[model samples]
Target: MINNRYDFIMLFDVENGNPNGDPDAGNTPRIDAESGYGYITDVCLKRKIRNYVELVKEGEKGYRILIKADRALNSKFDEAYEAENLKKGQKGKNTDDVNKAREYMCKNYFDVRAFGAVMSTGDNPCGIVRGPVQINFSRSISPINIQDVTITRQARTTGDRMETGSTEMGKKSIIPYALYRAEGYVSAALANKVTDLSEGDLELLWTAIINMFEEDHSAARGKMCMRKLIVFKHDNVLGNCPSHILFDKIKVKEVSAPPRCFSDYSITIDADLPSGVELIEKI
Candidate 1:
């Protein structure tokens, strides 16, 4: 089991693509209205990590993904109860049984162990778990410019349009270029006492983060890459210092105006670190 707390920073960039879309805004790239800075939701990143884990470790023991595509959540809750050989009880009355199922979930599902879950909605409800790892939303270093590109396709869904040979028009939202930074935390205390998150699981989490974008390729999200992963590992279960202090040591500055690529920005990491904190650069 892991014996130390961890704080990490992730640097990623997107070129000519929408990193994340705002469903409420005609599927445009998510942006801060006040600052005009682009941002990707934590849930978006978590989904990518989960997808990567599922892709690499499919059908592997203790690596199942609880929240996955095309699968009903309640069925998973039922599976938990069935696997534990326990029957579902009254919604709020089966504390012991719920905890047992929750343990089963944490043991079998990698996401539950890392990201936690609220399994209180279904008939066979497992208790909620506060996972060991948590990630914040990633935000760009500067305001970004969003472009709406019009696209045309010759093929059409309707047979009449096909006969007419008229092109179908579509719109795509894209960011010319943006470098985003995300912060995350891992609690050894929670890993040990709550989720049973082991050293192997921690390593898997890092691997997932570093390679999350590799298999997730499409025309909408073009040329996305993980630029850097800066990890601050503490000596003890409780961290040696505040996470903010450690995060402040890393600085991202744009070397050119209207930066169009990653080379136009300079990333600096301070060498002098706090006592008992070791910095590991996992790119």
Candidate 2:
């Protein structure tokens, strides 16, 4: 079981692509309208992490993804109840059976152990689990610019358009370049007491974060990469210092205006750290 708490800062960048698009705004890159800072949702990052875990740990025991695509969540919940040999609980109430199913999920699913889940939607009714790991939304350091690029297809879809030699025109949203930072936390208390997140699981979480974007390349996400992963591990289960204080110790500044690459910015870390805390750079 995990015995120490951890806080981490992730730095990633996107070039010539949309890191995340807002479907409501015609799939434009998500941004803070007021500040013009680019945004990538926590859910979006989590999905990439989940995909990485699922890919690397395929068919491995205790590494199943709970919220996978094309899989029914209620069916998984039912499987948990059936596997535990417990009867389904009534609506709005958690029983010992429900607790058993919840434990089953925590034991079998990596995401459940790391990120937790609410399994009360179905008749099986597994109780909610407060995961040991949590991540915040990523925000760019500086204001970003979004561009709409137009492209044309050689062949037309419709017969009439084909006969007229018409081409299909499409628009793609992109950010010329941007660097984003996201903060994440790992709770040892929750890990030991709640989800039983193990040391191996913790290590796997780090690996997943470091490689979340490696296999997730696409035309839309253009050239995304994990630039830096700075971790602060406390000596004990309860952290030695506040997360904000540790976060403030690291500084990211744009050395050049209209930055288009990672080297255009400078990142500085304060070597003098608080007691009972150790900083590890996992890039």
Candidate 3:
């Protein structure tokens, strides 16, 4: 099991793609309107991570995903309670059953233990868990230009195109180029609370992050790739320094104007010995 605190910075780039779309805005790429900088929600990134993990550990034990697309939540909670010869608790002090169900979920599901979940939903309250690992929303270092293009399909659903003599028209969005950065933290003490968070799991996480976009292909997302991943590990179970101070050391310097690729930016790390801390680069 992991015994130290960890923090990391991930840099990824997208070319001619919509990394994340805002449903509220007609499925356009999400952006910081004032700054014109694009951003991807943590939920969107986590979904990709979950997909990668599922692909890698499909038949492995303790790898079932709790928040799968087709699974029912309440049913899973009920099943967990039944496994421990228990029932649902009514969201008060008497939450032994909820704890039992949460334990079962954390023990069986990788995402539940890695990213946590709000199991206290619907009628089967399994309580809530604060997983040791947490990731922030990734944001572009430079402003991005979103381009909307009209698309046409050759055929129609209800009527034949021969009669109408017209193709189905729709819209799609894309980003010319954007480099995004995301930060994450892991607490060893928090992992001790409910999960083992073994070194194998840690390795799998790094693998998933590196290969997340390889299998997720679509017309809307084109030429997506991870550029770099830097991890700062602390020797203590708590931590060596504040996260903000550590993050300040990793700098992204703007080198070229109207940047179209990852080469236009330079990533630098300050060399200062924060005692009991180690730096590891996964990419």
All candidates: TM-score: 0.97, 0.97, 0.94
**Candidate No. with top lDDT:** 1
Q: What is the lDDT of candidate 3?
A: 0.86
Q: On TM-score, who's better, 1 or 3?
A: 1
- Alpha-carbon RMSD to native, per candidate: 1.1, 1.2, 1.8
Which sections of candidate 3 miss by over 4 Å?
A: 88-94, 160-162
What is the TM-score (0 to 1) of candidate 1? 0.97
Q: Which residue ranges in model 1 land beyond 4 Å of their true spot?
A: none
lDDT of 1 by residue, 182-244 (tens): 999999999999999999999999999999999998999989999999999999999999999
Question: 116-185, model 2: which lDDT tens digit per residue?
Answer: 9988887777889999899999999999999999998887778988886777788898999999999999
TM-score of 3: 0.94
Candidate structures ordered by TM-score, highest first: 1, 2, 3
Local distance difference test, each candidate: 0.93, 0.92, 0.86
Off by over 4 Å in 2: 92-94
